[model samples]
Target: MTSSFLQGKKGLVIGIANDQSIAYGCAKAFRQQGAELAVTYLNEKARPHVQPLAEELGAEIFAPCNVSHPGELEGVFEAIEARWGKLDFLLHSIAFCPMDDLHGRVVDSSAEGFKTAMDVSCHSFIRMAKLAEPLMAEGGSLLAVSYYGAEKVVSHYNVMGPVKAALETTGRYLAAELGPQQIRVNILSPGPIMTRAASGIGHFDELMHHAEEHTPVRHLADINDVGHAAAFLASDAARSISATTFYIDGGYHAISG
Candidate 1:
């Protein structure tokens, strides 16, 4: 049954590269809850894959938004402003690490590679918050994806781990700054899901197996698990929840042995 918790609300979904993406899952949930959406693809190559999903979600504004690309992020906001004049929520799920840096020890990771990873994975979310602030005059929810590796040393997680830690910190600070305006910022740290982005991490199959065995649920959290939580955060139901990390890991983080 279609829900109305988000009825008459508008949201922007960034970082969906394909149907399997976490962003896609969130967008699907948002639409099911009756929220109007604006979705963006990273670039031309990503457009073909993401466009159909946007259409499926009935996104009214679909644009290209590779934050690394100059003006692209702003263009997406402009499109939203033109169509909806405001936003109720935003999701940021994109991250990156040069393969060499990602596979190497964090200590050996080059300064330039570290900078690039921080820029794309951590800083991009900050940029989006800046753009979304004005459009969220009525206040809004801003969500980003992080991981267990941010808080613990997952073997082979490498440079991206530190980058994710930064992301979590960034979210908290943004939440504190934006709270007075009623704009909530929160982070979702999902357990291993085999999205295209997750494929970059080394020994990912092993990580999945480990997560499956260790989690209290004895399985990984699927995209739907994430989608539902995101919907709640974006809704008024979670109005008091902000500046926190929701670990969608099926109790894996709870395991001690």
Candidate 2:
């Protein structure tokens, strides 16, 4: 792999639950581009899954961070300061909604489930950007993952669709707020991909097949494609771009039945 793009850069990639995760793809691409990395797993349950991937990437740090908890977020930044002192990029790939809420009608979604989804999927990015701002003394890039469901409704995407809408809006607000400091903020929306998180949503396989058949490209996005898009967005090449969401989907958003 050519290694000129991200040499000597340092970044924190949050929300990597396992090797198959989109965050994992971003982390790998960052490594290949010569960026040093740090990754966060949610809790003890995710350590074994995250550890090998961290080691494989030669990550400078690995820490536990549950974005829902303020203390965990504080501790993560503390560790980053103690180790790297400053950061060049931050990736927010965290999001969650109760399984029960995901498979049902949006009107049927419970209040608690809606709140949980918004907190984890939307508010967390806002909190992360606030926390990361001070640490990025030299200015930096911030990237978050979203989905087409945030706009056009996807069956079984219920509460998460709303959460992603909030997330995308948050990205725009942060982009505007941080632009003066030269910190770029953007969102990458990937088409249906087979990750563990997607597995939790009902009928994901059928959704994937449907996307493949309808999208102009006639195939699904590979993890690396999404990662490469992220790497570019987080790199100097994308310095002038912010307050925008880039679709990494294979033209799935443009087709009409």
Candidate 3:
């Protein structure tokens, strides 16, 4: 069931750490739908894990984009400009908080940890958006990943919850700001699944089981599910869609108890 819905589109994907990463899943889907891709790895340590996936995706440009690193993000965009001259879409799927801060109460999180979380998980997207803006001269989509905890209280999702909330709000503002340029921005919030990042969360198994049990569909979304949504939103088919959040959770977010 491969489709050409995304044929001729060119996109950049950031935050792919390994095969199980949501970024990998979405990038896979985009390739399946016939889009050209440029993918980023975090660093040399992450390069081995991510480069193989980038090869599989047939990415035309593979570069490093450690947003925290002084000039890495800019270098990535510079590579994109040299290689493709333009970008049709961009995906920001990275988030982080030190495990200590993540497992502790939000109020107890150190100022440094909070700032780090916000800078990486939230502010990074803003930076990405700014870098991706001029490259998207033809009006394109910008997307990022989110979680239910951003809007509600989810155990073990402390600092990231607020960080993700900031990300969602940032998406809206970027959408409004970039809409005039025909650049669309949106957020995708998925239920718990065992991502490498998720494994860092305290009581994550309990969280996953609880989500599956309480979810009306009696299951949780895998990376593929989120990927398909990302594919749809990134396509020309979703041209009119922007500045919104799509929950990929299986009815769990709607449950009362």
Superposed Cα RMSD, model 3: 1.2
| Model 2 C-alpha lDDT per residue in residues 1-257, reported as the tens digit of each score | 45668988899999788878999999999999989998888989999999999999998888899977769988888888899898899999988888888877889999999999999888888888998898887789999999999998888788888889989999999999998989999999999989888899888899899999998989899778999999998898888999999999889999875
**Ten residues in a row with the worst lDDT in model 2?**
1-10
Q: What tens-digit string does per-residue lDDT give for candidate 3 at 1-257?
A: 35599988899999899989998889988999999999999889999999888898889999988899999999989998998889999899998898789999999999999999999998999998999999999999999999999999888888888999999999999999999999999999999979899999989999999999999999899999999999999998999999999999998889975
lDDT of 1 by residue, 217-249 (tens): 888998888999999999999999999999999
What is the alpha-carbon lDDT for the whole of candidate 1? Answer: 0.93
Estimated TM-score for each candidate: 0.98, 0.97, 0.98
**lDDT assessment of candidate 3:** 0.92
Among all candidates shown, the one with the greatest lDDT:
1
Backbone N/Cα/C clashes per model: 0, 0, 0
Write the number of the candidate with greater TM-score, choosing between 2 and 3.
3
Clashing residue pairs in candidate 1 are none
